[model samples]
Target: MDEEILVKKLKARDQKVFQDFVNEYKDKLFRLAMGFVHDSFLAEDIVQDVFVKLWQNIDSWELGNAKLSTWLYKVTVNHALNVVRSKKKTSNVVDISQFVRESDDGGIEIQIPDNEKNPHNKLENKELAGILRKAINTLPKKQRIAFVLRQYQNMSSKEIAEVMDLSVSNVDVIIHRAKKNLQKQILKLMK
Candidate 1:
């Protein structure tokens, strides 16, 4: 079904709508949380908590003003941020030992694909995706959240500002810094 119909059903208090919503976005939400937490298990737990929060608050959710996906994105971002913050309080530096591991053949390669548009560039693109994911993990909390919402989640600056509870200019600044940081990290990794 179309997003509009699914959301309308949800707003109409359909019980099964929440299940459909979870099924539709669970993987994406989990990936998003993992982007921040960097631990698959913790990320999965966070995604579940986010959905529970959504289900509990669905009645008060104003599906009239925004797309359900947008709301979901906001919720996902906020939940991921909360996880990041809480973990920070309890653990200052999260270990990156999990994200980095040697392959049977060799170590990690950090390189950008030259011909990204080529149909046969899938392998190179996958390598580049890995490098990009690594680069994202090194970003600071605000920059990471801003970049993820803007780039991966396909959210505009205004929407990110709303999700992160920051001003539009703050979102813009964070994204700019994030891009610069990403570039520096990519270059450092390539060296």
Candidate 2:
């Protein structure tokens, strides 16, 4: 269905349309939430909550102001950030290595080349992935969000700027810094 028609149905409280909408966006939203919280259960809950909120507030959504997805992304990011902040209050230190071992990759899968399928190479790839995950988790909040939206979500900088409420140039800078920081962190971890 077209976005305009979907929005109309949603605003009219069409349950079927809402269900379809949830089905379509649930995984994307979950992955986005996971990128921030790094917990599958929490990410699931966050996605559910976001959908519920959207259902309740559908009429308040200004259709012409922004795309529905941009609104959804903004809400998910804010809610996930809130959860992270509250989690931080209860624990002063987070063990990045522990999370790397236990956490999901926010729906991202590491792909090994066919020619590099040796067991030893596979092990090295997994280790490198873990290092990368840890480095990403350590990034500053804005940088991490920007990087995830750009890299994992494959959103354009303009889309990210809308979701993050930043200028396109600002989003670009954040992503750039995130890459630089991740490189430094990865090198440090390798040592």
| lDDT (Cα atoms) of all candidates against the true structure | 0.71, 0.79
Clashing residue pairs in candidate 2, if any? Answer: none
**How would you encode candidate 1's per-residue C-alpha lDDT over 71-130 as one tens digit per residue?**
777777777777666653222223333335566689764333357555646654444445
Which candidate wins on TM-score?
A: 2
Off by over 4 Å in 1: 1-5, 11-13, 89-142, 154-173, 183-191
> Of the candidates shown, which would achieve the greatest lDDT relative to the real structure?
2
Q: Write the per-residue lDDT of candidate 2 for residues 1-191, one digit (tens) a residue.
A: 88899998999999998998899999999988877766678889999999999999999887687889888998998998788777642122232342233227566343443545564655444455555556677799899899888776889998889888899999999999999998887767755
lDDT of 1 at 58: 67
Please give the range of 10 consecutive residues that has the lowest summed lDDT in model 2.
89-98
CA RMSD (A), model 2 = 8.2
